[model samples]
Structure formats: structure tokens, C-alpha cells
Target: MANQTEVLRLLMANAPEYCSGDRLADELNISRTAIWKMVQGLQTAGYSIESRHGRGYRYVENNQLSVAGIQNGLDITPAVQLIVLPSVDSTNAYLKRMATRTPLTEPVVVVADSQTAGYGRSGRTFYSPGETGIYLSIGLPVTTDQPLDAGLLTTSTAVVVAQTLRQLFDVPVELKWVNDVLVNHHKVVGIMSEGITNLETGQISTVVVGIGINLTTAAFPSPLQSKAGAVLAHPTKVTRNQVIRQLLRTFFERYPSYRSGDFMPLYRQLSMVINQRVSLKSGARTYDGVVLDIAQTGALVVQLTDGRVQEFSSGEITKVNLLTGQYHG
Candidate 1:
């Protein structure tokens, strides 16, 4: 571990209470001057640390997201490490490269304050403005006899994210088809799952699930302003670290059920378009249908206009009209 990381761990272990400079220096085997420098660096990086001449230093609970803060919040054994970045092209892209170069354990998470090239389903650009949203990707190792469809991972993540947000904010969150979480009919979260497959066995070796959330964004780019929204109109008691920790913890807890298809019931219940009329766009063809149900394998079972019921595993929902029961791409 780096000296700075160790210093943060010590401070977090004794948060809201002063950790004397002498004690910190002695424990970290560094000079008190070094401790002061580390504290200054942390403060510069957006951590709120309080210093008293005689009392030493204390980490104030300001509810901001930091590597140390997230580490402190997690209570699970075999701790999940966090890699926080100021800016990145995409968390998923970074972690994918890391996974190839290094062996990753389960539940490794990468978080970015902003992503310049964040993408969604069908390679659509995901808007990730700096300091206003959560752009995270979690890599999980899976070994199974059956091939894991990437869509299942996307749907399961959507369920976990929606459930976590609803529980945390006491708000209504709904899932739109395969990978979107909506609130008040506007998108708040976009999830995309990418996997590394074993060519010989055709099984997914690792799954990287990336999610972009609009937490407190005031305004979006003109292209997304009409349909994109944040979780809150303004900042609330919720902190970015809180959301990250809760999301990871909840996802791990629910992942087993999700894998076993037990989450299908709640997924169906939380869906925003189960019974609504929607336009399903698969490649060049578009079909208007009413959503009847969602299959356990994560396929959308739609009743088409010509009175034929069909299941689509992958498609873009171009448009959905609730009042007039009309849909079009």
C-alpha cells in the first residue's frame, strides 16, 4: 500500500476524532511533517480534514466520495479496493485493459468523476459531465457451464441500481427495458455490460458492468436536456461515496438471486414498459408492440401489432406512447 493510502486508512479508522500527529507518524513510520503534507494533499483532493494545534487532525464527515472514505464505509470482508480518477475516457474501458494485464479479483470497482467517452447501448454516447454524476464500472469473475448472455447482466444491474436508488432517496425509480433506470419518465441511469468470452467453451470469463448516473446535474447538453435528468433537483444528504458503497454492497448481495433468475419477479414489477406500447428497433426494422412480459433470460416479450407475440433479445426502444397507445422509431 502507498503511504498516502495507509495514512488515509488510519485516519478513517479514527474518523471524526483527532488522530494525534505523533501517533499517526509513529504508526505510519513517517515524520510528523510528512503526515502534515499528506493531510494537506488530501484536503486539496476534496477531503475535509480538520486540524487543531494540540488535538491533531480529524476527518470530518462531509459525505464526499474518496478512496479512503469508500474503504471506510464498506463493512464486507476481503475488502474491495476502489480506484478513483478525476477524469477518464471511460471506467469500463480502463478496467477492461487492467483486467487483461492483471488478474482481477471479484468485485473490483473503478469510479470516475467524469467520463469523456462514456457510452451506452448500441454504442450511443453517454453524457458524463464532470463532478455531477457517477460513472462507475464493476468487474466480476464468473465461471459457469452455460454461456452468460450479456443482456442478463445489464438487466440485473438495472434492477439492483433502481432498487438501491429508490431505497436511498425514497423516490420512484423504474426500469426501461434492458438497461435504463428512469424516474418520472426521464432517464437517470444508463447501464451497459461487456464481457470477455472464452472462445473454446463460449462462456463468459469476466463481466464488466458499467453504469452512468446523473446524480445532481443541473442541466444537460441540449441533446439530452429533454430526456435526461438527475436523481435530485439539488444536492441532498446523499454523498457520492454513500451511493457507491451502497450500490456495490447491494449488487453483490443481489447478484446470486439475479443469476438464478429469482430477480425476474421484482424486475418485472419494477419495469416501466411491461404493459405499455413501445417501438422496438432491431437493426433496420422497427416493430410496434405492446410489452406483455419479460422472459427469465431477459428477452422482451412483445405483442406485435399484427396480433403476433414475439420475443426480442436485443433492440432499441425508439419510442413509447402511453396515452395514445402508439409507438414509433
Candidate 2:
């Protein structure tokens, strides 16, 4: 019997035209019942599937999360293995377990339609609700020729996401210190990167970048109602699959430019922190500073209030009101 991926490929490949059950079953060597089940599963995942009594099933359209839809016209192939799930606790957590179980030979991208335990920097829960947000993690193993710049992948990814949103929606997107994407003073996306290192060789064994994006406008919990923003404030035909394709396409195709810091100029252009007075935190200590510049190595260079200069690579920029440019909750 064929899997859901194959079934979806067939349906999406022949959109607006129904594929007979018998023919689909014969092609996949699965029973008609199995085909019916697969179609039900796809429908449950937010795909728009139309059915008729004897016409079998036809794909009406997909403005939702569809792996087959994502793979259909995405030209950047051979770089990452894409895995889509209807739901997962967290794509980052899933990838960590996967890398731990079997050493990956190539890069792997895992995307979830929704995340249950989605989290961000500082172990805070990332507000991820169903059918409207994107939670993805790209696992990069040391096996690929792409040299791992442990310091900048998160920063580079921020650039890619910010650019993707701006290119698709023509909205002004801004980047907070490390990995937050903002618009209209609300955070629409959060990025977190985790990695394991080979202690003996002092090399990275695996690294995963988790990106959680509020794709469409949806109600949020009372706590996050003020800060979490959606990429599309209103409705549109833009789907999660389309956004994923554009992001992955640019991320891999321009791997060198981003990974090597050549994309810093654009990163700077979208930065919301430059020249802003900010609060910083490093381990048990905290300080206040005025942003100076983003170093070539993707560090935040700051001129401390105490007449000292400091650079932060992995430290947190203490929560400042993104809207008012003041240090607050």
C-alpha cells in the first residue's frame, strides 16, 4: 500500500480533476478503502478536498499545509529532506530525537502544522495554535559541505524569514536583537537554534533551527494577546505551504551568502535594534547600553552605559518594549 505522500501527490498533481478510487488504488497498489482513509486524513489537516459520489476525490485547492503541495513546484531540491506532520509537540524536539536515533546523511527539514509544546528563547512557551501557524526545524548535520557557522545561522535565518515576509506581503518586517521578527510593534515570529557538539573533535555534531510563525490572524491566549502578531492580518490565498517554499528556497540557494555573513548588509537594513537604547543580560549579570552596530560575526555591538563597549553573540537582549523603545516587561 502506498503512503499519504504518494496519495497527496496524485491528487495535487491532478487538481480540479477527480481521480477514480479504483485507478488510484491500482496505481498505488492499495485498496480503495485505504485511499478513502488517506483523503480523510488530508482533509483533516486543513487541505481543501472535494468529493463526489462516483467521481472519486479531487483537490479543490490548497491554501493549507500540504506536503505534496509544498514539493510540487519548489525548484530547490537535493539539499534538504522535507517532512511534514499534521501535529507535533515541537519540530525542534522531534528533530533532536531523530538526529539522536540515526545520524543524518543530509540536511533534514521537519515542519508541523501545529505545535503543542512550542517554545522559544529562555524556555518560554511559543504560542502555537492549530491550522494558522508554522513550526519548522531544519536539522543540519556535519556531513554536509556547508561549513557550520554556529554563531550566525540563527541570525541568517532571521534575515531569510524577514525577507520572505516582506517579499511576499510587501510589509515592513523588523528584526529584534537575535531571532525575533516584528511588524507594527508586534512579534509575528520567533526563532530558536539548538546544537550538539562533538567534544573530542570540537566540532558540531548537529544543529537545528526552529522557526514558529503566526501565518494568519487568529485569537491568542489572554497572556500573549498583546504581543503575538500574525503575518497576514486579514485573509488571503497565501498558505503556509507557499511561505515554506519561499523560505526554504532562499535559505538553501543563498546558503553561502548568509552562512558566510555576506548577507549582513540586508540584515542590518531590517534591524530594529540599531542605535536604540537597550537592556542586555549575560548570565547572572545585566547592563544597559546603546546599540552601536552588528559585528561581521553577527554579534550585537553595544556601547555600555558605563562607558564600556561590549559584544553579545549568544546573550539575551533584555526584554524592551519593541513598540515604545523602552525597557519594560
Candidate 3:
């Protein structure tokens, strides 16, 4: 039988039109029985395929994720390669391990259908159920000349993701300071950035930005039920590949601005915490303050109730209360 990727490509290329069993078998160099089995596999994998008695198979218009469809949608340069995995432990971990073994030539983007050991900021387990979310990581080389601020990278990523989601779905997407994207005040996206630095010069050599988005997830773990959310409220016609392609396009387009610290302005505009009463947790200590602004370097500037203004470069913003005067996580 033809592999799932190849089968998908053939169906997508001739979408809305049935490709006869004889044609599929001849083109794939397989038997008609093999074609039937492959169609069953595609249906099992969430593709909506309709098989008629005489018309053969037709690829229905549905929200199924397709690697070929996504690759066709992307206008990325040939130097950048996109790899889609049926399953993986984690895209970030996979790319990080690959970086250690081989010298990465060009930018490599690894996207998985699901992650078994997906993680987020501070080692939190990012809920990554299969076939419902986008798990992607980009491995790119960065030198001292184009220095990247690790703090700004995650925030800038959130900005671009929020912008893309808003433009695509025409929904209200907001950025929760530092690494989370929220819609309707519920988190829908989480981002993490890991890099290797030169010990001598204290500059980063390579950086991998990992992003996980809950696209059409219907449920979450009990612990995250109240905090987590998917971007789409209803099952629309958006496919996973479309989301992946648009995200990559937006990220690369805005990446130069992120390197130049120009994304801070848009980050401030999409911020959910700014001007809101917030509770920040740093280690065992907690501070209650109102977020005044986000610094150019991506730090959260806050003014405490006791009339002291402080800048927090790293901390967990446990809670943000837009309506209430007091905030608690």
C-alpha cells in the first residue's frame, strides 16, 4: 500500500474529484486491495474520505491535518526544511538532540502530530493530546553579531502567534506576558525557548523556539481544565497544516524585528497584564502590584501598592485580575 503521506498527497492534489481504484493502484504501483486498505487507514487517521461504488475515492473537505497541504501552502525558502512526524517524544527535545550529534546546516523545522513528553516554561507539562494541537520547534543558528535576547524571544513569539491567530480566525487573541497566549482570558498557546551558548564569549550559538497551540482540543486534564483553552470555539474548516504554515511564515517575517527589539511595541499592545492588578511569584515570595509597562528587554515593570516600582525580568505571573483590585493566583 502507499504510505499515508503519499496517499494524502495524491488525494489532496485531486481533491473534490474521485481518483478511481485502478488509477490509484497503477500510480502507486499497488493492488486494488492495497488501495482499499490505504483508504481505510486514511479514514482512521482523521481524514474524511468518501468511497463510491463506481467513482472510487474522493478527498472530502474537512479540517483534517495534511502534511502535503501545509507544505503547498508555505512559501518558505528551499534552505529551510519542514519535517512532519506522525509521533515524537517532543519536537524541541528531538531537535536539541540532533543539534548535538550533527552540525545543523540550514534551519530545520520539526513538527509532530503529538508529543509524548511535551513541556513548557518551568518544566510544566504542556497538555499535548494527539491530533488536536500544533507541536512545533524551529532550530536556527544565531551568532554574536545578531545577538538574541532570550527573554524577548518567548514574548516576541507570543506576539507573532497571537497576531496570526487573530488574523486567521478573526478572534480576540491576547498575549499573557512572557510565554502564554490567551483568548477570552483562557490560555490557548504556550511557548519555550532553549539555546546553547558559547562558554568563552557568553553568546548564544543556536536557539530553538518551541511552540504548542491548542487548536481544536475539546478537553484538558483536571488540573488545567480552568486555565487551558483551544483557539477555535467550533469545529471550523481550518486544518493543522494551515496553522503550521501561517505560524512559520509569521514567525520568520517578524523574527528580524524580534532580534532588533522592535516587537516590544506590538507585545505591549496585545498584552493582557499591562495596567491590570497582578500577583507575581518569584521563588517562595509573592508580590502584588499593577503592571505599568513592559520594558524593551521584555521585563515586566510594576508598581507595588506601597508606592515602589520594580522591574521583574524573570517570575511567574500567577494571576492577573482585570476587574478586581486585588490579585491572587
Candidate 4:
């Protein structure tokens, strides 16, 4: 009998047209009963299978979180299961609930078509339009011989996401220090990583990494009309599925090294803020300095004109002229 993947492939190949049960069964050389079971399974797995009494079954159009599309694009076998949700409050929150029941690994990916409550760094609300963007979260379980600081992981994710966007979309993507992806001087993506360690055991159990990318949309909220944007806000339109696939492949390719605590090399090579001048803003205090480099421990190293170098962890900083598309001080 043809499995779910094969059945889905047939439906996708014959989209806008219905595939009869008998035809599907004959193609896969299986009984109609097996085909019926597969259809049921697909529906339960979040694939919108539309059935007509005489027209047979057809794939629904605009199913944003298509498991079949994502499965076909993945090159590496997933270590953790990929759960595709049609609509959710947030992928991070959903996966956190699953982590309590299931032991999630590095490759586990959770994707949603839309989020009801998505936010950027510092609790700024993220505008996620249904079927208009990529909203994903990953769970990374860790236990280090030495304690791993939280800020390092956030910076690493920020840099990787910025590079991934640039390479995939062929755009001038920039990193806003902690966890924002800017394209053409506007915010297009946001990443957040939260570490969870057992208090009594002191063992780092899991790090929930959330990534939100704006794609396909053409405009931002009314208030953000002057500052934020989607990829379509640039010169081209990128599919949400493509963004998710590229990000997953890039992450998996680099994750092994990160797991071994050797990600500094990749971090150094992908650093976008180094050698650029940025403004650190916190309340009334603001410091403008030239970025020297990012330390192995994930500190932003900066050198003032007076020759004083300082390292900032996270928060308390923002790239000067980030929205201007200029890296100059």
C-alpha cells in the first residue's frame, strides 16, 4: 500500500483535480481500504483533503502548513518529528507543551501557518498574517560539562538567521544585534531563544528557539508603515515554505558543530555587526561605538575612539541607523 507521503504526492501532482480512490489504489497496487486509511491519516496530520461524493478527493488550495511540501524538501532525516499546525497561539508555546510529554531533540521542528500571539525581542508584538509568513520554533536539548550562557545562543541564532535570509532571498539582510533580521533597512524577521535548566539538577534540559519571518506580505501594520517590512516589501516575493526549508537545512548543516561547542568558527564567519558602529540604547543612556568582533562566548566587542573596548551580552543594545540601511556610524 502507498504510504501517506506517496498519496500526498499524487494529490499534489494532480492539484485542482480530484483523484478517485480506485485510481489511487491501482496506482499504489493497494486495496481501497488501505487508501481510505491513508486519507484519514492525512486529514488528521493537518493536510486538508477535500472529498466529494462523485469527484473523489482533492487537495485543498492554500494549505499553508503543508507537511508534504516540507517533507519533500528536507535532505537530512529529521531527528525530531516535524509537527505542522494550521493555526496556533504560537509554535514555541505549543512545542513547550509537547516537550513536557516528549523528549524533543535538536532536529524537531514545529511550524504554524499563523500565530495569534507572536512577539519580537523585548515583548514587541509581531504582526503575523495567516498564510502570509513563516513561523517556526525548534527545541534543542543540551547538557554541557560547563554551563552554557543564554546570551551566546541568542546571538548565534540571530547571526545564522540573518545569513540564511540573505543567502536564500538574495537580499541585503542585516542583524539588529540581539534577534532581529532587517532587509532594506526594515525589520523582516525575529528570533528568540529561551534556555531551560533544571534548578536542582542544574542540567540544561532544553532551549526553545522561536523564529518568525515575514514573507509574501507587501505591507506592515499602519504604525510600522515607516519602519518594518516583509520580504515582499523588497523587490521580490519569497514563499513561506522555501524560507522554512532553507532555514532547516542551514540549521541542521551547522547544528552538529554547535552541539559540539565549536560554533564560534561559524559565528565569526557569519557575524554581521563586527567592524560596524552601533548605538546602545537603554533609557537615557546611549553609547555609540565601533564593533570590533563577537567573542567566542557571544559578547559584542566594541572599541570606542578613546580605545576602550567593551563586551555587551544582550538587550541594552541596538544597531545605530539600522532602519537607514547604512552600516556607517
Q: Residue by residue across 1-329, what tens digits does model 4's lDDT show?
A: 36988998888778769999889989999987898899999888777789988777897644456666776547874455788887888888787777756655554689988899887667878887887788999887765653455676666676667767777766777665666677776777778876666666777677789998877667677987766777654434445665677778777676654534366655665546667667776456777888888777766788866789977665456556433345432
Clashes in model 3: which pairs?
A: none
Order the candidate numbers by TM-score, best to worst. 1, 2, 3, 4
What is the lDDT for 45 in model 4? 76
Tell me the tens digit of each residue's lDDT in model 2 across 92-158: 9999999878767788999997888998887999988877888899987864466677668888899
Clashing pairs in 4: none
TM-score of each: 0.90, 0.85, 0.83, 0.76
Stretches off by above 4 angstroms in model 3 are 1-11, 14-58, 61-66, 198-203, 283-285, 324-329
Candidate 1 lDDT over residue span 1-329, tens digit each: 23776877888889878999999999888899999999999888778889999999997756556787776767764456679998999999998888767646566889998898999876889999887899999887766653455777778888889988987896778788888888767799998888866566776677889999998888888888788888888777777888888888888777655657778888999887888888889878999989999999899999999999999999888888774422221
- The top-ranked prediction according to TM-score is 1
Give the distance in Å from residue 281's predicted Cα in candidate 3 to where it truly belongs.
3.0
Model 4, which residues run further than 4 Å from truth? 1-6, 10-23, 27-63, 101-106, 145-149, 234-238, 259-272, 281-286, 305-307, 322-329
Candidate 1 stretches with Cα past 4 Å from truth are 77-81, 102-105, 145-147, 198-203, 324-329
